[model samples]
Target: MHAFVHEGNELIYKNLNDPVIEKGKVIIALRAAGLNHRDLNIPSRRGENSIPLVLGSDGAGVIEQVGEGVKELTIGDEVIINPGLGWEKNSDAPPKGFEILGMPDNGTFAEKIVIDAKQVEKKPDHLNWDEAGVLALPALTGYRTLFTKAQVKKGDTIFIPGAGSGVATYLIQFAKAAGAKVIVTSRSKEKLGKAKEIGADLAIDTHEDWESLLRNETIDIVIDSVGRATFNRSLSVLKKGGKMITFGSTTDDEITINIRQFFYGQYQLFGSTMGSTEEFKEMLDFISKHQIKPVVDHVFPLNNTQAAFDYLRAGKQFGKVAISINR
Candidate 1:
């Protein structure tokens, strides 16, 4: 098997002995691996330690073998790897971090990888492997953030910042499906055009005073994945009693907000992260039923992962950048 290993802050593909599946686990022959900003940001624990640690989290593949005690999936079944394995499923369970497939351990950016059978789902027959690989994370996050955390409803006007990112692209489509009027903002004009193409009701230039442009309007929900750079503006554009749902901090993590402004507006601010397994399933089903597809900016061979990282680092992509493997 060939895998990209993190050998001291760099990614290198090298030969490895075949992975042995444990009881209740399944081994997948990966076809396409999705590359995300987090994939590029995973650091070696110690400066002297290896880097590029099998370097991907999201992937789609066909089952090669199932370990003893595995029953739900079998050989030759097409599936997508679910990266978030052990967050709480029960409402009563407290939020505790669980080991993810790629960052702290082996990931899917290889010829094959093994994981618990529950971590894999049957991929939609309508989508090819490359599309399924990138759709899970972004679509699940967007679906959960808007539908559950924010409780967005029909006719709601939701504003999303950093409209060109993978999550935002999916969010716009999902929001429209829910009958919400969608407003998007991005610094890049090209990305804004792309957003409109993908069904955003309106695209606002981040460079201009969008606040003034939106002064008289009241948005029902504001999804601010861009963080600090647009946090205050997100706060400014919300309707009284409306909610603000923020997920990622692509720009900067820290931001200062006026407590008085929140009180005066009676605003509700919520933070979301990657969703649970159930949410992932719901997102997959929604995509399947609605014929929604993720926007893939580009695809690179597994060996050219560095080029993929360079592309994402430039922050000019309209959506996701994927690395094809095992195909």
Candidate 2:
């Protein structure tokens, strides 16, 4: 079997023996895999990861075989992995043993992979292979942020910062489908326009006076994935008692919050991570019901994963960057 392996902090293609299916695990013949910002951190794992680590978190494929005690699944099942290992339901935070795929475990950047039977879910009928492969991570993150954490409702005003990334793209569409008024910010005018074309009610240029433009409106919820760069300004855009959910810190992780304003306004601040299996299913069902197709910026072959990671790191992609493993 061939896989993209992390060696000396560099992601390179390698051919290794096929992984054996352990008891209570299943083997998947990957059709497609998707890239995330986490994949960019691979180079930093110099001493942490052992030799030849397979690095990928999201994917969809078909089951080639099932391990012991797996009564529900069978060979030839088309599915997308939950990726999240421990957490199975919605909660205030991930469970004690929570782990995402690709870091500690071998991931989907391979021709074949193995996982616990509990990690797989039947692929949504409405989505194709590439779409299903990318849907689990960003969609789960967006769904948990909007529906579980923020509790977004119809007619609510939702604001998302850094509009061009994979999670932001999914957030824009998900909030819109739920009948929320979506506002996105991007430094690129063209990216802002693309966001608007995809159902964002308002797109603000981050280079300009975006706060001034939103001076009259009170945001119901603000989802900030940009971290330090937007956290302070995001608070200013929210209404009194509004909610703000922070996921990734793509920018600087450390931030200063105005203690007086935060307490006086009764604002709610929360943190979220990749969602549980239950939330993943709910997200999948909602997407299937709404007929929402996740935006794919480009599809690279498995051998071109380095270029895919480069594209993601350069912040050029408007949506998910996927790899066609079977191709």
Best by lDDT: 2
TM-score of 2: 0.97
lDDT against the true structure, each candidate: 0.84, 0.89
**TM-score of each predicted structure versus truth:** 0.96, 0.97
**Model 1 per-residue lDDT tens digits across residues 48-136:** 46444677888999999999998889899999988886864723222666655687778878999988898899998888878888877
Could you tell me the lDDT of residue 327 within candidate 1? 66
Which residue pairs collide in model 1, if any? 6-50, 6-51, 6-52, 6-53, 7-51, 8-50, 8-51
Model 2: pairs clashing at backbone N, Cα or C within 3 Å: none
Each candidate structure's count of clashing pairs: 7, 0
Candidate 2, superposed: residue stretches over 4 Å from native:
46-50
As a TM-score, model 1 comes out at 0.96
